[model samples]
Target: MGLRPAHPFLRRVPHSRGLRRLRRLTRRDPVQLLKQLPEQEQRARLLELLRADLQSNEEIADETWQMPSLTADGRTADLPGFNFQTRVCDLQILQGVSGEAMENLTKTCRLLFPLDGSSWMPCTADPRCLAERLAQEVFEFHAKGFAFDPKRSGAEWWVQIRDSGHSEEGIQFHWDTDEVAVERHGVNVHPHLSTVTYLTECGAPTLILQCRNSLRPSETAQVYGSLAGGTLSWPKLWKHLAFDGQLLHGTVPKALAKRLGDLPHRFTFSAFQAMPRWSPVSCHAGRFRTRFGRRRLLHEISCRLPHRSGDTTAGTLQLHWASKDAMLGPVEKGRKREMVSAGGGEKKGCLKGEIH
Candidate 1:
């Protein structure tokens, strides 16, 4: 006897309390809410509600977007240096759409897993129109001297709605090597240029650290300097920022992660331009690995050291790949001592360093 199919009315209901809360949060104008609160309580309440709502939602759990990978050759000498450059200007090109329209687009769009905890979905905005304008701006910035052809190079365009939370604890410092695509095909096609258009101002400022001068790239041209660190803020809504993809950048420090966890409801539209040829070396991972070819191995180094302020109590220093599917092992002490990936492989290393 064949089993009968379940009726449509008998289908399981989606219990996404987090998604519902998110919808409610976005539906109301944050500016009006802030205005309604007294000045003294505004800051505290804003932070509180943002954090509480996000924390309450089980669907919006924090997860790292990318983890650092080791090179196949085991030589870290060729690693790409950190060079972050920012340009602030009016995004007149994208002014065609009204702010309300953009906000609505961000709110109603579907959310897809970014392979990281940061869920993302495509935007309703026209990808081709945005790409064309961005390409024109890039050309104007270089005075027609830019070698890469946006159209001829087969640049891929996308408008994604990204939602990240305090659970992310600020993404670990990493680069956007377009590793997701490369791993799928095991090919070198990756984004060389990345542009971010801020749709809303809801999170902590992104902290960009400069790679040490000793680690600067040996070949090719580099922009920005080898400074220690800098913070990028989105003071106004609808501001656009573009930067080279080959940079070692991360979010705020661990100290401020708690306070900024849910304060910012980051909504952004991003575009990625691909390179003409694939390079064997990746900015984040030392060498590219193809999916289904071999098991990709990651090395994690952890150590404990006293605080830089001369405190005797030891603080753990963790250097490991951030996994999307890894189940963390129990904490032997105050820190997570070990992590086991979904694949069941285990490896460990140690490194001692002064914590400042």
Candidate 2:
């Protein structure tokens, strides 16, 4: 048998005139064009171009990981304080596996989001391990990234993984503990870290938080915009409280806050309740006692209870303060918001919040 030549048509496709024209169109300096056009016109044109690009890329076979299909219909996990922020109305549904989970989810803004494909991107190792993984990842990432001062600072980190779903298509994300405080401060609270994945094909992993924490029944929640799948890390918790970093950085002027009464603090209470899978005592012995509260501090022991049993609630309540202490601050009532360092004395009351 003789070796055969590859198709010349395939080899020469790159030099096609159509491709050349497309390259020319896409290669133009968008900044230069924007400079030439009126500001409003420039913004409109850019949006149109972006929409066109997104639409055109739909047919392009994504070279990245294959997105998981929603094979499992839907499953829900109901636990205490699941909706402390929004009443017992929080709901989280497990869809399926996403691509390689990333760390430091908040820092995703640094890298352009991979918008060329349809896929679920998880931040934790396994679906069951979501909360644990989220907590650990946030801790390690922030510990390394944020230069916290131990002497003058009692800075705390709060982490919560919420189940966000609606109809057939939806998403879930990590909520900050300081959400309530941020609303009061009219400042941005760093999400610090978050993990998000889409449920449907057209579903994008976007975090939509209402500004001013709207109370009107007729008004809908504000849309924060699409969040890329990955880890985001930041120093102070105050920086992420706003709607969009673009507006925060002044890269783009926004009318949302002024027009819609959108304050940086407006956000609906996240509806995912966190159940503590592990306690500080599990981390060590002397450490657990030192970290937990002296008022209700009980011996470190594991006792199985029904999914919704009263005993489980009691157990969760006991460990709640300790967990918050461990995670630092920005604690939410009802959910495990922090982790107590083994042996650290419980010096603070449940950092001010309604226990879900």
Candidate 3:
């Protein structure tokens, strides 16, 4: 079957007029048009851009393997500061994924995202789509087996591409708190876990923090209290790494500070949270299911979190630091911000924000 125009990014043009209009648009060069347009307009989900680049098509994998964990594998891999030994275990890295599957998935982004004004897009993949398969498989096998809270957890995932000009300033640290899901429930919460499925080899190392927002409320008026945990660094390519989302994480963006040098872009399938099923946040994931159908899904994840991106607060604490060694400035006790990281014996970027 031919590709359908169900998404703005994958518009199906029929008829002499529509085809002619697209031909005209494509003729002028969509990339140049995107650069010239206003930021808001450029960010819009544009059929023209999608079609131009794609006409230029719209757009993965097979193999499956799960990392060894105490629950499923009887023994997990060794990472000095990683929480592989946590009560239910806190991290898992998947390997031996089918190259065919990822190639197809990356095809979905290659032409459009780089040329479009935005670095990311809100999208859903069908059961046949690799993204759906990746998320569902992880939930059924690893998450369920490792004790990820399903009632309060569903995957919030996206396929991301990192530009070569990655910045140290771009990396911010925080925990993935789903406070909004339980806002009406009257209790605070965080994503049960998180995962990253790599489409490309390692670019920059993601700093998985030892710190997290405390599930317990602050006893004193002391805003936040932190018991620093060591750090874990370095991520291998073609590996799937899953960890407790409540832990803080950020990446080493500067290529100079990282092993990767001179590469232009990096790709990965990332999940910030696996939200509660009943929350409005989970409902945001529905658009993809509605469009793509039910063979598999990302538990209906909305690309953006409901909370603000402002200062770090109780459940949402943001850390400003360059590299892991760089001193982490104290987080201001500001209003709640939405976010999601790892391990270091080095006492740095240690922050366990308050619950209320």
Clashes of each: 3, 34, 21
Best by lDDT: 3
What's model 3's overall lDDT? 0.33
lDDT (tens digit, per residue) of candidate 2 on 52-104? 65556333222432222111211011122211121111112222324422222
lDDT (tens digit, per residue) of candidate 3 on 1-356: 00101111111112222223433665443344555778788666355545555454321111232221222221122223334321111223234546665455565444333342211112232343444355555554443334322332334444445553343222334444332322333322443445555455445444454454444322112213332332323333444555565555544443333322222233333333221112223222111000000121111111111122122111111222223222223333452553211121111232121111
- Candidate 3 residue spans exceeding 4 A from truth: 1-99, 109-126, 145-153, 179-188, 215-227, 259-356
Ranking by TM-score: 3, 1, 2
**What TM-score does candidate 2 get on C-alpha atoms?**
0.19
- What ranking emerges by lDDT with the best candidate at the front? 3, 1, 2
**Candidate 2 ranges with C-alpha deviation above 4 Å:** 1-36, 40-44, 57-356
User: Each model's TM-score, in the order given?
Assistant: 0.37, 0.19, 0.42
How high is the lDDT of residue 59 in model 3? 17
Better of 2 and 3 by TM-score: 3
